[model samples]
Target: MNLVNMQRKHSSYLLAFFTSVALMSVGTARDLRDVTEPKIPPSCTTLKASGGDDTETIQKALDSCTKGKAVALSPGVFHSGPLNIPSGVGLVVDTGVTLKAITDPALYDLGAKTCGTVDDVGVGCKAFITMLRVTGSGLYGKGTIDGQGNVTLIGQKKSWWDLSEEALVAGTFQNVPRLIQINNSADITMYQLTLIDSPFYFVTSIETNGFTAWGLTIIAPASARNTDGIDPIGSQNVTIAHCNIRTGDDSVAIKAMTAPSRHISVLNSHFGHGNGMSIGSEVNYGASDVLVSGLTLNGSLKGAHIKSNTYRGGHVVNITYNNVCIVDVKNPIYLEMDYVHLHGNRTPEFRNIAFNNIRVLSTGIFILQGLSDSNPVVVSFNDVHITKGSRWSRHFANVTGTWEEDASGHCGYAGNE
Candidate 1:
């Protein structure tokens, strides 16, 4: 349908559904980017990279670092294995330094002979940087953390990305390490960090509260598999702002795997060559109360997506996207319920999603699919302008509100930081 000032025919039904309800009140609004950036703490200790393995030196500094202080890595190339960050401490990679992860699978094996191999259960490798059960801990720097996904393994001919492709063909999973893993931790921060070429997901947090990712630059090749930028899983009160992410998978994926993920905000971010902002294929618990504002997607595979199948499905509500711009994106607005054709008993719900002041500069396929006719996706639009030749494929959706083809306004889109 030509989305020109379109109004829902069943407006009365929606009005009755929300007559006494406030949609924005569905989840808490604890945006971490609402405050100013904190000053970098003074360094408790600084260590120059030895010409050999620096994992022991770095780990020792972090383990002995004082609370409310950071351990600084001097400006040099440092090769290391897995490193842990203690609670109430920080790690800093100073400018002109590149901390590269060693490609030895044995160093990352979790006592399961699954690292550097393919299997059905792929969670077998530990992250390069682990923050477990920590509070007030962070990674701050202007330098880079290079996972070296393209580098060949110590004893294998294939690199990390090559193994990922092989696993896809073999119908299994590649046991590769993630760059950063934050688990069971609270009040964590990642500031001004440049992450590149992760073997798996770049940064992931699970069951943690009060998380923030600000001024992050993440990049990966388009062919790299499973390289998600930042994923907040089963976490609440989170914010990701001023990020420029280009990855193989979702730039920012909000998931509810272990618990309900709620009260999150993603503001003023730019995406390129990735599956843009997304809300899970693992939302089995629920995900609610998310606000994404002042965003841009350029040359992306998908933009503003929500994908979930019956096996990993649950309630997704009270999401808002405001002041967004898209250019040369393929699937502009994709919301699917039968993702990957996974089938089960859990029903998926998408409700009260709002898009305001959006502009798409290129024509692309737009999809909004729900599970069934009885469980249609509920969404609204206001001042959303797309290119004239765009095509829409909608199924089992109650698309309401207004849209236009006059894409003249800029939507206040500033590219990236």
Candidate 2:
């Protein structure tokens, strides 16, 4: 029992401690892997190959699904009027399946309903696929949703574009229906789908929460009217990621008319030929704590724009745009409180908007004009470089904020950049 015995005992103790620690680590890893639910991929149920007025047929398929079921569409065209998607169901469109919307206005139109006004956009009765109070559901696939936006309606020589323009000019548009509508729902996911040529907004959500949309291709003609891509209204804890959008209107527009939309994040997406990511052209209620990151906006009309008329305006605060690259965009970073929709008195409250690490190429008239009564509070920027535009071409009025200078010497504030 001398020094050699004591050293041997100490070595044995160290070995025991190391072995226990390694075993504990392996056990923790196993527990982490076990916490995730066993994904069953849902039960697969295919829709029937009906030829005409597939609304009732498709409704039957959707209604026949048990909770958390997968209803798939086969490889062909299924013409449908208006349809309903049940809750706790996942819709899968196969590689060649196309759910074509019937343009026979009478088929889709239930009755004369009010269109998108101050706080009433997604509340109407006529949508291609409507899901109300549907929870824990998903509509995803590698297929297409053909809205036939270019078709000429009955008794009209021109296509939907010309008709839509006429409606916009006349200030009363009730001619088209939206592609997909999800209202007052939660825990929904939409992914990897081609939503094209809608009569109105391609995909819209209202009063919903915990929504996630990704890998979507939303495209329409530039001449097409009001075809917005991923419109999220009054939804919270939402994440839209890796979506490509080329539509006639806003690619990712955040609207809050009836309820406030908060804690929303849009990550790693591309937008073009549209009104870029926007907030509150119709923020009638309020919005807060929204984040957009890793966006590539190419050849679009506006990038990170916020447009609202005085009458249909409310608070939009604590927004952040980070690591964005805007290429060949016109009128990048525009904020107009007085959008030409017949002005009113109540000003919108905007505050704490930050753009970090933004790179712009080829833009015209970077304007941020907030109303005098409701000056936006502290719109700051960091590492924003506009390489292809002149500083004099940029316009600013009444926006009281602070921003770091881009390489082109364009600052966000009136003082030295």
Residues 1-417, candidate 2, lDDT per residue (tens digit)? 422233244444554553344334322211111111112236557776678777777778788888888788888898887877788887777589998887766666555533222122333337888888989888878899888878776555655566577677766654567899899998788878898899789988899987778788999987787899988998777777788899998998899988987778777788879888999777888877777877888888888897776887888777777778776677778877777764676567766676667777554557666666436433554456665433322223322222333444332211112
Backbone clash pairs for candidate 1 read none
User: Which regions of candidate 1 are displaced past 4 Å?
Assistant: 1-34, 409-417
Per-residue lDDT of candidate 1, residues 260-328 (tens digit): 999899988888998999998899999988988879998889999998989999998888887789888
**CA displacement after TM-score superposition, residue 383 of candidate 2 (Å):** 0.7
Which is the leading candidate under TM-score? Answer: 1
Error of 1 at 196 (Å): 0.6
Task: Report how far off residue 336 is in candidate 1 (Å).
Answer: 1.1
